[model samples]
Target chain A: MNAAPGVVAVALVTLATLLIGTWGLRFSRTTSDFFVASRTVRPTLNASAIGGEYLSAASFLGVAGLVLAFGADMLWYPVGWTAGYLALLVLVAAPLRRSGAYTLPDFAEARLGSRGVRAVCSLMVVAVGWLYLLPQFQGAGITLRSTTGAPTWVGPVIVGAVVLANVTSGGMRSITFVQAFQYWLKLTALLVPAVVLLSVWAGDGQPHPVGGDGWSMPLAAGGGQGLYLTYSLIVATFLGTMGLPHVVVRFYTNPDGRAARRTTLVVLALLGLFYLLPPVYGALGRVYAPELAASGRSDALVLELPRIMVDGLAGEVLTGLVTAGAFAAFLSTSSGLSIAVAGVLGQDLIGRVPAGRRLGGVAAFRLGAVLAVIVPCTVALAAPNLGVARAVGLAFAMAASTFCPLLVLGIWWRRLTGPGAVAGMLAGGVCCSVAIGWTLLTPDPSGWADTLMAQPAAWTVPLALVAMIGVSLLTPARVPGGAGRFLARLHAPETLDLDRG
Target chain B: MNTPDPGNPRERVRVTGPPRRRTPSAVRPPIDTETRLGGMYLRSLLREQLRLAAGVLLALAVLVGSLPLVFHLAPGLSSAQVLGLPLPWLLLGVLVYPLLLGLGWVFVRRAERNERDFADLVRGADR
Candidate 1:
């Protein structure tokens, strides 16, 4: 494949992202602005930003690839992802905003009033952020390799540098604009090609895609295991969205609880629209390039489909467009994740350092950003290529297990003591991490072990919730005295003139 | 002036009727009930929100959770063609997104309405 179009596209995307970030940098000065865009972002823009960051390489490339490989069951990936926001909107969004916390750790410390709980939450946030970032780096590598025949490492290095630059400079304010722009770019990149491809298919008499017997089935061949995997996937995705570190932090940008809720509603619509196009690629790929699926390069289906279906300049241009979108996806998501991780590290780790009290807020955050990106980029280089969607799913499982319990219980139950929160998080984190580690190391496992390890959310989430409730009940005296006031603040509308303080 | 002792006793008697009642204009009435921070009031609001969320979750659960069972029991349904695509293909790929959006729309509307109702109740109680 010629490298000019792809290189130009990638470079253009990088330039645009940096330019936007620098432009937004003017508005980012104060600590609040650095952390949550000064909590002044309106709903539509925030929703766009959320959609942009949320639809990562997993959504842009992974969904189509998974669908091409696994057929109908893979639909669960997108469904679970989009529906996760629904869960967020209903259960977490308003209350979390009302809680007046900037990050998950902030919420934890405020709710449980324990240094230990905050510490655990900080650690988990880092873990999940790294886990999520690993795939993005890997996906960038894959995209670059396929498009330009560059060494695999180049992609991760370039993406890491760009993300670091954007995040360290402007923080959340810059990322919000960059990500919002990316959402539209991604949608257009996919939508225009989908429309053209459909027309081409119609012109060519619309050949039917060939799918074998089990392709359309919801479950895999192993009857019981398949059921387990499906349910586990449901459990993970449905509960996990609220816990994602980057996603939860975005809600804090909303002006108030109502705007936060509104942002979520718009996000659902935006995601729903974007999701429609990927399945189109998947379905069409089944007809046009089934061999890619067999050869295990189905993840490139979205990138390669336009060229396969169209001819000459049009195909090349379309390919360039998609390459740009994919690059944007990597940059946007990596920046968001980096900002989230850096914020945590800055506040809890670097900022806490008593090194002559020299490091200021921006300096601490910049240092944290470097640490956040470097570890994941290095890991991506060392680790074997886990499919992007699968890796992200594991991250979700981890989040669902840990933060989901923390958020749900912290908001609703006044009896959630600090010790209980710590216990629950540890239990969930350990269980999910073990399963993820086992899967990553083993590569291929069979029988019940495969099903259990691959999708740990079903068991792990319940374990976390149970541990939290049980431990809280056992140590009722440990419940924070301010729990009642906190609950009232979280649940009441902003219109209510309550003494939240 | 004519009866200083009698006048002093009468003034003390007039001031003794609960200071709050004596100067109702000077003191604003306590709005604790309107604040909705009382345990019962807070509980009811939480319950209302939880109920709305649960109802939305139930709808989503029933719609999505049943797909595997349906596909398993009636394998033919998966293969059946709809809109020139397999039933599963059309449903999962195309239709599910709209359904999710609709459900989300309904949930947001109801949730906001619940909040609105709670706010109104608090304001009414204040009056």
Candidate 2:
């Protein structure tokens, strides 16, 4: 009864991984299976797997906490995340598969016919992947430290080790199964406690969460800064969805364009369903655990609420359930990203040089998995907290800037030369990197520029797209043959997979 | 590395202009109009791709550019009572996602349709 939810969540995650990993063990064998489950994953199953991996620690803990502190505006984070897949489904998914590539770099090289483009794509994938992974470890540390009073590093270390174990064991194949199971586990974890807490809150007179300063609206609300911040969030969520490397890579696991579309639809529904519950927790946190808001770190809303709202055994069990789901959030996302990063590393870095022959296939993936997990885990601890959802928002901005324009131009515009693609990535990367560097390093900036720069995605995606299209127009001669054809494929995925007129 | 299909070589692109020269693929084989599709069909494919690409680009631009406009245009709307719920609740809580979902679905379908049409054109050429 005394054991905290954080401790229980970790245990549940371990059990779920062992069970699902075994279930997937039978299906995984060849390198192809390891990489993409042989591309036969069904829409429904893949949808759940997508949900499992995509619903990160931010979704589980940070978002609800954000809502508790920042009102309904914070809801956009999850909504955008869910909708981003829809963009992927429509724009990139089927064509990506039809391109018949293993990674984003593979697709870039295939489209533009340039190794240099591939190298840049690879580098961006690693960068975005690392940025995205940082929150998972940070959340883990927060969960563990808050629940059990353990050393903060314990959370990230355990998260990294568990993620490494799952990813190295079977690549995407094993991780897919692991993720799908965790999705349900996470849903139940959050929902069950929520239902109980709501019942408890209602029992205690159903008052709204109070304690202002931390829980109410922003200080500069209705001002230029507020307006700019909101719109910037919209842009990042809207465009950034298309560019996340791990998420985009998942579409390749489907059998065809039709399957990819179907998978996206299912993902939208599943994600929408899952997203409905967390904000309720945040709203409830206002009533039950307003102290968290005043003290800062409202991100620990889930961990803190159960004890204040419910005491003794009931609270402990509920906390454990939340912890398990929280752990699932960390594990599924980290594993998915790790697999993507490892695939890129294996094919581009290790495969090209042949030095990694000493570590083959799963072994290589295992070693790569460590890179995928540990670096971010260490960073999560050493670096100052970005606040889970806000940090994730930054990652989205980067993805939108660099990958979103690259994919759109590469897929649709025949005039996109190798030079244009290179130029676009460089411009987007530079702007985004500077913005992020400024945000983290300075944390304070001049008026309009600071607002514009803090939320770079709003303008950066456009800047990159404009640069790409402008440069592309100048060098129509560089447009590759079949550019039209390639675009047709990207837009019309199901047609290729079907035997219709 | 997997060796590319070897059959493409013998046929190479012949530039239609005065150069009238053979276009070569640095490695595998030069891309040629290997199919029997007439010039008219190739022209049609090019036209259709242009139309679709333009539409997709316009849609993305409009979506990205209009954020400031949407909030600014809403009359005396405070942060509350947007479509029954408040603006923040409505936008972030619900409508934005569905809007995004609709747009994303459109993008995927359009992209897929474009792909299928191309594949068909190429297949028809092959036929």
Which candidate achieves the best DockQ against the true structure? Answer: 1
Computed on alpha carbons, the lDDT of every model, listed in order, comes to 0.89, 0.74
Q: For candidate 2, write residues B23-107 as lDDT tens digits.
A: 4323311113223343344455545645654565467557633544565465244344555444545555555555655665665
* Candidate 1, B1-127: lDDT as tens digits: 2233764665432334444313233322223333434666778888989998889889988887788778777777877888777788788777888888888788778878887887787666556
Among all candidates shown, the one with the greatest lDDT: 1
What does candidate 2's lDDT look like per residue over A182-292, in tens digits?
889888988888888889987988675576433333222446676677777867986787788888888789997678777888888778778878888888887777677
User: For each candidate, what is chain B's TM-score?
Assistant: 0.69, 0.48
Candidate 1 chain A: worst-modelled 10 consecutive residues by lDDT? A212-221
| Residue A382, model 2: Cα distance from true site in angstroms | 2.4
Q: What lDDT does candidate 1 reach at residue A292?
A: 90
> Model 1 off-target regions past 4 Å?
B1-37
Chain A vs native chain A, TM-score per candidate? 0.98, 0.94
